[model samples]
Target: MPIAHIHVLAGHPRPVLKQLLREASAAFAQALDAPPERLQVWITEVDPELYAIAGEPADEVLARTPRAQAEIPLIRMALMEGRSTETLHRVMAALSATTARVLGGDPQRVRVQIDHVHPDRWAIGGVPASQARAAELARRAAGQGG
Candidate 1:
């Protein structure tokens, strides 16, 4: 499951958060080739002036008419194995683009991080617990097994 925690200072409308949740969930589902029901997302609106911008303080960013700063930390995890680096890169691009478009953030300043996950984090349809990170860990462990 993918959970995007958008920790921005409180002040934004509720619809915005809802929209974010929808977009994030869809993005993750498509990115991992999973069904929409298989994804989960969370939007956390932090207090204003909590997150900083650039090297300066976030209060400065809040001083603007928007009066709110948003820090979108998105994490999409999938049990699928064998995703190429290029594929991951494109996913990042699409995610960032969509987030920027939806949330009205500076695309240049936006950031997105991708990770391979263990499916165990989710027990789909009462399936047994599993680790989405299993294969990745195994690969890394074997690489360093020596």
Candidate 2:
């Protein structure tokens, strides 16, 4: 399973935010070679007055600079910890590209952080994933030929 949490400065239109959710979900699914239904993505908008850049309030930054140039969305993702480094890199690049495109910001400014968790540490319905989804994990491992 893959879960992505996107944090952006408040001000973007609702439609843009919705597009980000849809596009990002597709990107993650495609890059992970996983079904769309297995992925989860959500966005949290932060008030500009509450966020800062270089010790300056983001509201002040936005007042002087264009929103596209001033805004930098931070994306954090959590996934099971068995993917190869190459696969992780691909996922990061895909997410960065998607965030930049949907948010109208430079791809280089997008921030992506991934946290890999062992199955024993992840849970579903109060049961550790290691035990609750062992068969599914086995099938995925087999499909990946790992």
Q: lDDT tens digits, residues 4-100, model 2?
A: 9999999999999999999999999989888899799999999999999888999999999998888889999999988878889999999999999
Candidate 1 TM-score versus the reference: 0.63
Model 1: how far is 30 from its true place, Å? 1.8
Q: Whole-model lDDT for model 2 versus the true structure?
A: 0.91
* TM-score of structure candidate 2: 0.95
lDDT of each: 0.57, 0.91
RMSD of each: 6.9, 1.5
Alpha carbon lDDT at 58, candidate 1: 60
- Model 1 RMSD to the real structure? 6.9
**Among all candidates shown, the one with the greatest lDDT:** 2
Off by over 4 Å in 2: none
**Best by the TM-score measure:** 2
Regions of candidate 1 where Cα sits further than 4 Å from its true position = 65-82, 118-146
